[model samples]
Target: MIEFIITALEALALIAMAALVFNSHRNRFLNRYFALFLVFLALWVLCGFPQALVQEPSDYFITLVFRLAHCMAVLATGIFFLFGLGFYLGRAPGRTWRGSVLLATAIMAFCSLSDLIVRSVSYDQGRFYITNGTAFPLFPAFMILCGGGGLLCIALKRRESIGPDRARATYILLGFGIFLGLAILLVIVLPGIMGSDITSDYTFFLVIIPTGFTAYAILKHHLLDVRLAIRRSFAYLLTLIIFGAPIFLSYMIFRFAFESHPNLETAISIIALALAVALSPSALRWSNRIAARLFFSGLYDEVGLLHEVSSIFTSTANIREGLAAATAIICDALGLKQLQVAIPEEATRGKGNWVIGCVRREKDILGFQEVEVSASPLFLLHDPMLLDDDANAGVVEDVRNAAMLLEMRSRGIIACLPVRGPGGNVGILMVGRKVKRRALDPMDVDLLHRFCERAGLFIENYLLSSYLLSMFEELSETRKRLEESDRFKTDIINVTSHELRTPLTILNGYAFMLQDHYERFAEDERRQYLTYITASCERLNAILDQFLTVSRFQAGAIRAALKPTDLLELLAEVKAGFIPEQGRRIESDAIPLGVRVLTDRSYLLLMLKNLIENAIRFSPSEMPIIIKAEEKEREVMLSIHDFGEGIAQEELQDIFQPFTRLEEIDKHQVGTGLGLYIVRLIADLLSVTVDVESEPQEGTVFRLTLPHA
Candidate 1:
C-alpha cells in the first residue's frame, strides 16, 4: 500500500510539472528546452524496476527493454545540459556547441551497445543480477561532466550578468543545482559510501523541486510565454506515463538498496515519516497559495495591460495625438524604450515627404521620405522580421527599405512593424527593444501587429478627412471671390448710370432747343451748342466701349485674330488720342515706325490705348509719358512709362486687378480704375505677356511683349 501511494504521489507531481510546460507557447527557446528535459527524465525513470520482474537472460525481451532504458538514461543527461545552456543564453546552443554535445551522446550510445555501459542481467536465487558493464563507469563520469559542469557555467555567468537576467540565472542554477547534487549522491555517491548495498526509491521524486521552481518562474515572471502556445491533452498524457513508470522503477531500486542493509531501509522510512508529520495543514495551504499565485500572476497582468490599451484606443479621436498616446501607453505598459509611427503623404501618391506623425521616447523626429518606402524592394514585406542594428550582411543589405530606414533613424529598436492598408503598406510602427534588453518575443510581435492594424485604419481615415477639409476650404474661398465679383458688377452699373445720366440729360436739353427754336440762337451759339453735344457723345462712347470690352472678356466671346502688325504704328495711333496738357506730353520718339509683331491689330491698339490713358492719368501734369518699343530675340516689347507719383513697388501687381487704385492718386482724376486691368486682359487675349516695373515715389512702367512676326 505504501509503495502504491509513493508511485501515485510521484506521478501526480511530475504530471503537474509536465502540464505547466506543455500549456505554454512552444516557440520559446526556454519552453522547448524544458519540455524535452521532462520527456527524457521520464524515459530514464521507466527503466527502473523490481529484480523479479525483469529477466536477466539474453533471450528475454524484458532484459532488452531494461538495457534500452539504461541507454536512454545516459542520453537524458546530455539533453539536460542543453536545457541549462539555453536557459541562460535565451537561444539554442550554437552550431559548434551542439555538434560537441551530439558527439558525446553518440560515444555513450556505442558504449551501451557493446555491453560496456550495461553488461548483462541474471536471475540469482529469485532475485535480479544486474551485472556492471565495462563502460558503466562512463555513466557516472558523464553525469558529473554534464550536470556539474552546467551548474558551474551558470554560476560564473550569473555573477557577470545584471538585472532580471541575473536574477533568473541565479534561481535556475540554485533549483537545478540542488536537485542534481541529491541525484548524484543517491545514484552514485551513496552506493560507494555504503559499499553498494543501498538504493534510493525516492531519487525520481527529487526532480519535483527543480520542475516546480521552473513552473513558478514561468507563471510569476512571464518566462516561457514570450512565444508559447501549449495544448491541454498533451499535458494529461504525460501525467499517465509518469504515474506508471515510477512505480515499476522505484521497486527495482528498492531491492538494490535493501539487499544487504536492513538498517539503511529503516533510516529512509523514518526520514519520510518525520517530514509528513512535521508539516501542519496551515503550512501546506501556504505552499499551495504560493504555487497558485505563481501560475496565475502573468495571466492577470496580461489581462490588465490589454484592458488599459483598449481603454486608450476607445478614448482616442485625433490620428496624430492618438498614435502618440497609444504608443506612449503601450511602451509604458510593455516597458519599451522607444516607439515611432510614420505615414506617407497621400496627396502626391507618395511622391512627397513622408509625414512623421508620432513618436514616444524618441529624442528627435525620423525624417524618412515617402519615396524611400515606396520604391524600396522590401516595401511589400508583410510580416515583421527581426532587425539587427550594425547589420553588414543580412537585414541591412538593402538600405533603401523600411527596416533599414527605421534602424538608421534610431538605435536599440528591434523590428519594423508594417501597418497595412488596402493599397498595401501605408504606414510603419517601429518598436524599440524591451527595457529588459531582451529581443521582442513572437507573442510581443503578434500583439503589436494587431494594434498596428487598427492604428493604420485610423490614420487612413484621418488623412482622408484632412484632404476633404482642404478641399472645402478652397471651395469656400472661391465662393467668396464670386460674391465679391457680383458686388463689384453692381457698383460698376451704379457708377455708369450716374456718369451717363449727366451727359444724356444735357444732350437732350440741347437737342430739344435746336429742333424747336431754330432761329433763336446766332451762328456762333449754334456752333458752340453742337460742340458741347459732340463732347458729351464722346464721353458716352468711351464708357460704352469699356463696358463692351469687359463683357466680351467675361463671356469668352473675344477672339484675337493674330496677324503681322507694326508695333510702333499701333502705339503711335493710341498715343495720338491723348491730348497734350500744359505740363504733360506723350512721347513716342523711342519707337521705330516698322517694328513688326504677330498680334491682332485691334487688340494691340486697345491694349496701347489703355496703357497710354493710364500713363496720362498717373503722370504729373508736366511729366513726359514715354512710349518705347524694345526688341528681344523672340518678342517685341511696347512699354509706357509714367513719371507721376509712381505706384508703390508692393502695389504694382495689385494695380492690374479690376477697380484697384493707388491710395496716393488724385481724387479729381477723370478716369475709371479699370484702364490697366483692361490692358492686361487685352494683352492676354492677343497672346501677349505684360510685366510691370516700378519703385515707390519714382516711376512706373508697363511692358507689353508680343511675339515677333
Candidate 2:
C-alpha cells in the first residue's frame, strides 16, 4: 500500500511539472524538450502501479509494461541531453546534434524493447520483478553515457555564466545531478553489485527534486520569457495544492481506518469536503501573496502608481509643476537615486531647453538647466533604453548618442525613457540607478515604460492646451485692432471734411472776388486779396501732404535709409519750411552745428518739420519758439520748446495718437492734430526716441534723441 501511494504521488509530481513547464513557454525548444523528459519519467512511475497490482493471469501484460517503461527511460535520457545542450548554448541544438540524438535514440530504443534486454517478468511474493536477458548491460551503459553527458554540459555552462545565468545553471546542475545520480545508484548500482532491489521503490520519486529546482529558477530568477504568465499560473497551482492536501490526507485516513464502516467513511468524506471549502479563500490569498513575493522580491501596486501620476497631472494647474511633482513621486516610489524630465525647447515658448529633475531624499530640487536639443540626443531617441545593456549597442555606436549616454552614466542614470507623442517624442524621462545601486529588475523596467506612456499623454495634452490658448489670444487681439481701425476711419473722414472745407471756401471766395472786381478795386486791396488766396492754397497743400504721408505709413510703403546726418542742418531746414509769420518766432541761434547722428535723412527732416509746425500752432503768437540741439557721447538730443498755452501733463501722450486734439477744434483751426502723430510714426521708422514734458500753464518741450553714426 505504501509503495502504491508513493508511486501515485511520484506520477502526479512528474505530470504536474511537465504540464507547467510546457504551458509556460510552448514556443521555446528547450522548454519543450524539458517537458518531454518529465512526461517520460511520469510514464515510468505510472508503469510501477500496474506492475505491482497485475495478477498471475496477466503476465504478458506485465512484461509488455516493464519493457516499455525501460524504453521510455532511455528516450527520456536522450531528451534531457537535448534540453541541457539548448539551455547551455541559449538556443536549440544544431543539425549535427539533432542527427546524433536521433541515431542514439533509435539504437537505445531497439535495445530496450528487444527480448534479450528484458527477458521476462513474473509475480513473486505479491510484487512484480524483471528478469534481464544477456544483453541488458547495454541499456544501463547507454543511460549512464547520455545522462552524464547532459550533466557535464550544464556544469561547464555554470562556470562560464554570470549573475542570473550562473545562478540558473547552478540550479540545473545540482537538480539533474541529484536526481540522475540517485536514480543510477538505486536502479542499477545496488541491483548489479549487492544483488538487492532495496532502494528501487524510491527511484522514480527523485524526479521531483529537479523539477522543483527548475520551477524555482523560472519563478525567482526569470529563467524564461514566460515570467509574467508563470507568475499567475504558479499562484493558481499553489491554490490547488493548498486546497487539495488536507482532503487527500483525510481520504487516506478514512480508507485505512474506517473503510469497512460505510457510515463512518461517508462522514469522513463529508468532513474532508467541509475542510476544503473552509480553507479555499485563505488558501487563494496565501497563494497569491507567495507568488507575488516569489516573482518580485518587493511587489508594488502598479495600478496605484498610475492613478497617482494621473492625478498629479490632471489636478495641477501648471504643467511644469506637475512634472516636478511626478518626478519626485516616482523617484520615492521606485527607490531611485534620481529622476529627470526633459522637455523640448519649443514647448517652453523660447524660454530655454530645460531639464527638470529631482534627487532621492533631497528636498532641494536638482533643478532645470539649459541643454541644447542637438547637444543631448535624448529628444531624438524614440525607444526606451537601459544605458548599461548590450542591446544599446546602436546608441553607443553613434557619436552623439554615445556622448549623451556617457554623460548620463556619469550622472548615474540607468534608463532613458522617451515620452512619445503622436508626431514624435515630446520629452524624455531619465531614470537613475536604484537607492542601493542595484540593477533595475524586469518589474521596474515595465513600470517605468508604462509610466512614460502616461506621461506622454499628459505632455501632449498640455501642448495642445497651450496651442489653443495662444490661438485664442491672437484672435482676441485681432478683433480689438479691427474695432480700433473702424474708429480711426470715422475720425479721418470727420477731420478731412472739416479741415478742408475752411481752406477751400476761403480760396474760392477770394479768387472769385478778384476776378469779378479786379478793375474797381485799388492795387493794395487787390494785392491783399491775392495774398489771402495764396495762403489758403498753401494751407490746403500742407494738409494734403500730411494726409499723404500717413497714407504711405499705413500702406507699408515708407522705407527709411539710415546714414550719418547733420542735426543742425536738419533743424535749419525745419525752420525754413515754416511760414514767415511762424518762422519769425522760431529762435534758432542757440542751436550748434557739427552734431552727426545715424538716422534716415528724409524721415528725420519730416519728424522735425512736424514738431516745429506743432509748436507754432499751440503756442501764443507773441511768444518765441526755441529749438535747441545737444551732442552726447553716443547720441544727439534735439528739443523744440514752446512757451505759449503749454499742454497739460496728462495729455502729453494723447497728443501723439492719430486724430487726437486737446484744444477746441474751432479755436485751433490751423491745427489738424496729425503733426505729432506723423512725428511718432517717423521716429519709430528711424529707431529714434521722442520724449515730451509739459505743464498746463508753464511750457511744453518735445525732445528727440538719436544714436550717433
Candidate 3:
C-alpha cells in the first residue's frame, strides 16, 4: 500500500512537471521534447504502479498491464534520448535522428508487447516480477545504449556550454545519470550479479529524482523560463521547511515520549503550533531572501543598480574608462556575455566610435572587432530595441534600421538601448545575448533603460566639461601667442630702426659733402663720396627688399616660375650680388659645366644669394667660402661651405624659423634675420631639398639637392 502511494505520488509529480514545462514554452522544441519525455515517464510510472499492488497476476488483464508498462518504459527512454539531443542543440533533433528514433521505437514497442521481451508476469513472496523471454537481454541492452548515449550528449553540452546553460547541463546530467544508473543496477546488473530480485521493485521509483531536477533546471536556470512558478515553488517549499519542521519535530518527539500521557502530549502539540506561528514573520523574510538569492543572483534592486551606476559615472573623469568600469559592473549584475558602448566618433575626437567595455566570457577573452555599423544611425532609436525572435531578422520598421540590426546580430549583439542626453540621443548601449541565452525579461530591459539614461546624462556633462576646458586652453594659448607676437613686433622695430639710421645718415653726410665742396674738391674725392652714397643707398634698398619678401611670404603671394638652368651660371649670378669684399671671399671654381636642374631661376638665385650672404656674415674676414656642385645618380648637390664660429647644435633646427637669430654667434653682423627663412620658403616652392650641418669653431655647410634635368 505504501509502495502504491509513493508510485502514485511520483507519477503525479512527473505529470505536474510536464505541464509546467510544456506551458512555459509551447513552441520551443527543447521544451516540447523534455515535456513529452516527462509525460511518457509518468505513463511508465502509472502503468507500473499497479504492478506493486498486483498479487495473483496470472490473468490476461494483468499481463496486458505488465506489457504496457514495459512498452511505456521503452518509449520514454527513446524520448529521453531525443530530449537530450534537443537540449544539446538548443532546438529539435534533425530529421535523420528522429527517423532513426521512430524506427527504434517501433521495434522496441513491438517486442515489448509480444512475448519476445516479457514472457510473463507473476507474483511470488509478496512481490510482483516479470519472467524474461529469450530476447529480454535486448531490453536491458537498449536501455544501456539509449541512457548512456543521452548522458554522453548532456556531458558534452556541459563541457562546452557557459554560464546558466552549463549549470543546467550539470543538473540534468547529475539527475539523469543517478536515476538511470540506479535503475539499470537494480533491474539488470544487481539482479544478475547478486542473484536476487530485491531491488527490482524500487527501480521505477527512482524516475522522480531526474524529473525533479529537470523541473528545477527549467525554473531556476531559465532552461524553459517559468520564473513565476519557480518563485512560488520556492516560497511554498521554504514555508514548509521553516514553519512546519518545528511542529512536525515536536509531534514526532511527543508522540513517542507521551504515549501514555495524552494530556501532556496535547498541550505540547498546542505549544509547538504557537511557536511555529510566532516564527512565521521571520521565516517568511528568510524565504523571500533565499528565493531571490538563488534565482535572481545576477540582478540588483532597481534603485540600488541606479545608485551604483550613478556613482560609477559621476566619479570617473575619463569617458572610456568610466564606460568600461560601468559596463563591467552591469554585465556582472545582469549576467550578460558582453556590454558595448557606442558613441559618435566626432565626440571622441577620432579615438574610436565603439567601446567594447566589458565581456563576460568563460575562460577565453573574446576578440574585439571594429563595429561595422555606423553609430550615427543607431542614435536615432529613441527607445531600447530588442531583436527579432528569430534573431536573424530585424525588429525595427525602417530598412536602414533593419540592415543595422542584421549587422548587429552578425556581430552577436541582440539588443540596443539609446543613451539620450538633454539635447538628444548621445550614444548607444549595446548588449550581446545573455550568458544563459535567456530572453531579456522586463526587469532586464528596465534596468538597462535606467542605466542608459544615467550614462547619457553623464556623457553629456562630461563632454560639455571637456569642451569648456578645451575652449579655456585655446584661449590661454591664443593669449600666449599674442604676447609673443607683441614681443616680436617690438624687436623688429628696434632692430630695423637702428639698421636704417646708420645707412641713411651716411647717405646724407656724403650728399652734403658733395654739394658744399663740389667746386673746391678734386675729381677722385667727389667720386669717392658719390660711391659712399651709392653703397649706403644699396644697403637701404636691400633692407627694404628683405622687408618686401617677408611681406609677400606672409601674404602667400610667392609663385615660382620653373625652367632648366645651368648650376654654374646660377652660382655666378648669386655670387655677383654680394659686395666686392664679400664676393672676393667666396670661391666658385669647383663646378662642372653642363650640370643642369629643372628649377625657377629667380627662386634658385634668391635662395643661393641668401645662403651665400649668410655664409659671408658668419665667416671670418680672412676665411674663404667655397661653393661646390656635385652630380649624383638622381640629383645635383650644391654646397656652400663657411669657415666661421659655427652655429650651436640646439639652435640649428630653429635657424629656418623667421626672426630667429643665433644667440651664441657674433652680434656685430648686420641684417634682418630672414636669410635662412627665405631660403626655406623658396626651397619648398622649387621642390629643392635643403640640409645644413655645422660644428662649433669647425665650420657650417648648407647642401641643396635638386633633381637632375
By TM-score, how accurate is candidate 1? Answer: 0.44
TM-score of each: 0.44, 0.62, 0.53
Backbone clash pairs for candidate 1 read: 25-228, 25-229, 48-249, 49-252, 50-252, 56-121, 116-135, 198-257, 199-257, 583-622
Better-scoring candidate (TM-score), 1 or 2: 2
Candidate 1, backbone clash total: 10
Cα lDDT tens digits for candidate 1, 582-610: 22487775676577999888877777777
lDDT of each: 0.64, 0.77, 0.77
lDDT of 1: 0.64
lDDT of 3 by residue, 1-709 (tens): 7887887789888887777777655776776877888888888877654545655556466667778877988888888888888778766888999999869977998899998887876555645555778899889888888878888889988876555667889999999899988988887787677644567667777877887787777666666665645554676688888778867986888888988998887888788878878987778778877888786555455566778878988798977677777787788777788888777665555545655477866843343434444555553444645453423322256676676676677768877878888877777788888778886754577578888888888888887897889989999999987886686677668667776888889999988877887888899888888888988998889888987886687668988877888888878887788779888999985699899898999878888888888887888999999988899998999888999989889988999976777342238547777778888888888888999999999999999999898
Poorly placed runs, candidate 1 (over 4 Å): 1-366, 371-448, 454-458, 555-566, 576-584, 589-604, 620-622, 629-638, 648-654, 661-669, 680-699, 704-709
Candidate with top TM-score is: 2
- In angstroms, how far off is 588's CA in candidate 2? 6.4
Per-residue lDDT of model 2, residues 72-182, tens digit only: 898889888888888778679999998899698878888788786888876555444668889898888888888888888888777765556668888888888998889
TM-score of 3: 0.53
